[model samples]
Target: MATPAAASDWIRYWDEASSDYYYHRPATGETSWEQPDRWICGEGYDSSEDSARRSRAGSSLPLEDEDDVDAPEEDLFVVRASLSGPPPLPAGGPPPLSLGAPPPLPVAAAEPSSAQREERRRRVLGEILSTERTYVAALQTLEKVYMVPMRMVADAGAKVAIFSHADLDTVFLNLDVLLKLHARFLERLEQEEASGHFGAILSGAAKDIKGCYTRYISNYAQAEAHISALASKAPDKHRYLEVCKSHPDAGGLDVRSFLIQPIQRVPRYRLLLEELLAHTEPGHPDEADLREALARIREVAAFINEETRVLEKSLVRQGRAFVREGELTKVFLFSDLLVYGVPTGRGYVQKGQIPLGEGTRVERLPRTEHLTHGFAVVDGHGKGYTWHGESEAETGEWFEEVQRAVAILAMVARKTALEHFTAAKAGCTLIKFNHRDGRSSPRWVRISADGSAICWGDTKSKECKSMMALSKAVALMHGAKSAAFYRAQGAKKDRDWLCFSLLFRGRTLDFAATTAEGLFTWYLALAALVGPRSSEPILDEEALRARVAEMI
Candidate 1:
């Protein structure tokens, strides 16, 4: 073989220059053409070497490196690399070995010329791949947040652009995509940096990214604020609380005996105010009343915020203990049906009077006199019995106290049921209903305009607050059913019965208020309209199906 110097010098010339090489410069730069501006190749340049290099410039095309079969892939970059200047013929080194570079006219030359160029092209491809991956990843993250979870789109087809978790990625992707485009535009900008149009592409992309990001954050903040407002509605929920949170003591307390006129007026009025506000256009000058109502809501919210904390705590404590005969098996455990004969210590009884607790400490299961009005007979702890009160039950302090005390029990029971059911995903959410009497039953039910969702008529009771929760829990779990709520009339007052029409029915518009009698009339009318459940439904379906079957 020729001396190594000859071969090395030959290849080095092309490896460093070729226009083809720069075009493919992977990430870093690489060269091609065997000509040489040996500014980089130092220490020994003979007169011949300089003369050879000068000839190697892009002009008098002498395809140097390719002649060597061992040439590297750098020929790719060299084709693109810009080049200029004289070819360098080395000094009295070894004989020239043509690595495509012009050899010393039969002088010793060896070695491949394209080694460095190959390295350069590899680097450039890597850069492109990396940038593409980063951009795509950001786009995917954004899509996940805005499209998948929120909005009713999953239930209905089509997704809306809104903030969820992945919305951030969308914002990032916009910026990234813009930058990539900008970069592409600027590559042509290098030569004409001073030209007015040089970086127009990049500037445009930058602006696009900025606008999209701002819009995203703006929408995200608004959505988060709305959700926060809903959570903050807790205090306002108290405006409907009709029961006295704490009972009036026998001394300084002057309990109101009649319906809480203010309570009824406020919540209903607030609803009206909401409607009025809803009607007001944002910029309208005729919005003074709306504005005042909004101010009231704010103030009311603040006041409710303080009171709810105290009530919530008391509610929790009340939910834990119960007063009953024998050992407490499941105190405060509210369920639609209590499985009789649960095996517990102190021996339990399914019937007759039984003490709620030990010693003179007792509670008899009072008999409920009326089915329309639910109650359990608890008379001095022997064998407990059940009693149903009538629509004509007595009113007064005793009635109220007894009812309120029973309601306290109901509240605890409701809390127990709500906790247990919700945790189990049982679904019927027991929200407390607004009731006028603290001493009356704690009103709780699932209502609809037809009272058809749970019941057919309103049945006010001194007992509903306690029994209604269970009625609803059972109805929801089993199917639709409704229980009437009758206003408690101390044995002295005439019984006020609720009508079916007044009771809300499932899915009907609850825009009208009907009395107990009116509600009953409506239900009778509805029953008449539908004929009767005992009669076959959809006579046409049965006849049509029979005809089709006969034809088949």
Candidate 2:
């Protein structure tokens, strides 16, 4: 066996020029291609001996001490023989070589115990309580710092310079009611939290929360608009607001900001409840209650979302107008439909509805001998009905609103059409309809994958027995006359309610739906495939699907 000094002298170094590892014996000043034996490579060397060896051979790779070199001697030889040069050194130390005990297996992160989760849930509940206190305090500031002062002034019948009493009422609509509602809400939440069983506090307040928040959120837009108008058009109002904002009790937030706190608070409750629910474990005492509360909050959120969507697609214009010199009518033009109704003591009783789609038309007519400010609406069947506005401006406004509704309706129709056509192309278009030829069972119909034909069969059959080429097909929802004809042909009375006809190659195929809505839906699907193509760019299919969902 080599002596200790000679063993320490065996330095392993990588040669860059030759791309191989070589061992150098400093004692004999000899370098060789062969790896030295375990004894010569310092199998029993200490740190100090290895350090001394490294100090002497400054440019060579450091030798491992006895504790570091855990690999079998033969394995180390095999690793070195296979490699062209010394392996890359890892950041922690030299390359692992079956190293001592293989470094302890990585310890997985410990999962939070039930006790820890309970602690986290309590902490979240505490956060919610603290935030509620802060919110209630803010609402109080709005009530005390602004609303009370303004109301007192108005009640004294003093000349309030900045804004009218009505304006103030509009700007702070239902705010006091909301403050009282949330104060009670906060008290109940506090009671539950104190009892260490914060369960269903929100669900318990579901009725008041939904009613009050819906009223407040619906009127929030009017409140904001009133404030914005005052700020821009009323200098005294703007100065008064600035002065009130400087009050110490205002906490650096303006009146508008304080007013929005309730709006913001609603959504914050949702998030906090969700976080608390997450930290809560199954079968915990609070779990069921917490879930119920979350559901109620989510219901409120959904109501708000739906109301916003409806408001977005609300009426464009509505007013009194004469229909072809008929009885005075209330005409309401919406984004996608035109509705006319008979005026009642409270509101309008709806009389009729016309969908403003591809075949709908509106035109301004020159002042007629008997009708002033006259315009005509040609229905999808090319029949014209005239209306007279109260004045030229009213008539012009009606014309413009009708034109806008028509354009918007057309865009929506094109998008729906493209979506239906694409779904049919993907072999997904399937609808069930009753045949007017006295078939006892409803037939399943689908547009062909290439959108060239319509196929029909019973649901029990895997294959369609009847197919019609759509290239020359025309689909129309049946009018009263056509329904009368179908009824005379021995169709059921229910068939007269939701009947439509498909005319192709001089042959007519009549179909009916169980419901009137189903009649319109089927007509729309068929019309989309067979209707004249639109000039607008194709809409994204996913976006169209979402749009359809919103419309629904």
Candidate 3:
């Protein structure tokens, strides 16, 4: 058999059976013969349409070259046939039509030209191609089986039946590359075999695969290189198949924290609320109270959803009014609850400047102006939270209110995170919280039915992603600033200090760094500090007693 390099090099090829006799023919050399040796005929060549000229001895027939006709039937065979016996013969002589053979299979005999291969490739990779892996596998496997003739036409002296094996291997490898590679900038790298451009293509493919498979980046000149790299590492198709199956679902979008936040917070807060309400409620009936609370929740929910449907974009547009002069600010979830209504769904409030049209305008977010006074994010009761819209400067009797809000809101965030993690695993949305304003709620309160209390931070730290900092960020920024302003004028500072302390994880939070499992410890410490009367737990007589003993 011809080496792949030499076979592809020239227009000339020889009969492997007759080493000394070479047949210099067109790429597609066509002749009809019966029971011919296993020769790679000019399968791809267009046969001449002229009538076959027969050289017969009769005067009526065309005469052969008399000199060549008298020559003995000498076959210059290079490799002798391995068959042991002189078997069957037919009516014809030296031209070899004497041997009898059955007709060829239609699909096998219908030869494909080089142009046909190109057409097949284009058809297979068309725009509406199926991405279903199973279909891809079957189609690719079938293609490998069908390209036997083309392989022979391209490589003469190629083993007759075995030619398909090499063709199948190469085609399948190319398919693997085409299917797996993804890139932003792709340039086709098909080239002649001798120039060895496949090497360059392989290198480009490796970089492309790394970027596409690993991260979103610009890479790859052609897909071929990726196949070459994978081929080097895992020569067997099964290994490549395994890798393909294990890859992440490339078509789906990444799950963001928004959906996660709601689904998570809902169930966890429900459980915590159920536990808290069960312990705290008096055994004696209070149907009116539950009804009133449910009605209130409905009212908030409706208002939030309504504004969400109508004015969400306008509010988003006007959010820039919240940006202070040269001050950078973020949503501070509490602002979401009060001004717009719901971060998850909708809002009831319109986006108007503080002094009606006087505030700065915004077409986008990171609302900087009123940002300092919006909400706080923190962790309490062993979790994460956003303590909604309450200024930290709640001194002079309002101090008690800030403490109540902060403690409850912190528990809400923890439960939210837990609920989200759980729901994501289950692939469903379990919780729906409401956002609304509570102007009559002493300090500005925006409590969702769920436990999300978004508060603003007042510290110098501008962009804090910490749950604790977020819960109280608005208060820290606005209230803390107000507190400092007061301190500068010799105003009382007791309440502001307490708000800051509460946000810094209270006393338990202070000592929390030492514990390996500090989240629960902080919750216990905080619950103890907040005490039973304020919490008003509907405690199990036994559990409450145990808790009290532990606290002591």
Go through the candidates in order and give each one's C-alpha lDDT: 0.27, 0.55, 0.25
Candidate 2 lDDT, tens digit per residue, 171-282? 7888888889779978887778766577766567665777778887777666755564454356687677777766767643456656656655565577778988878988
CA lDDT for candidate 1:
0.27
TM-score of each: 0.18, 0.38, 0.15
Candidate 1: where are CA atoms >4 Å away? 1-259, 312-552
lDDT of 1 by residue, 392-476 (tens): 2421222332333333332222222112222222112221211222112211223322112232111221112111111112111
> Where does candidate 2 have its weakest 10-residue lDDT segment?
316-325
Clashes of each: 108, 0, 63
For residue 26, give model 1's deviation from the true position in Å.
60
Task: Using lDDT as the measure, name the better of candidate 1 and candidate 2.
Answer: 2
For candidate 3, lDDT tens digit of each residue in 73-113?
A: 22111211224322222224222221222222223233333
Candidate 3 wrongly placed segments (more than 4 Å): 1-283, 315-318, 322-552
Task: Please list the residue runs of candidate 2 whose C-alpha ends up more than 4 Å from where it truly belongs after superposition.
Answer: 1-111, 158-164, 307-552
Error of 2 at 58 (Å): 48
Looking at candidate 2, what is the lDDT of residue 276?
88
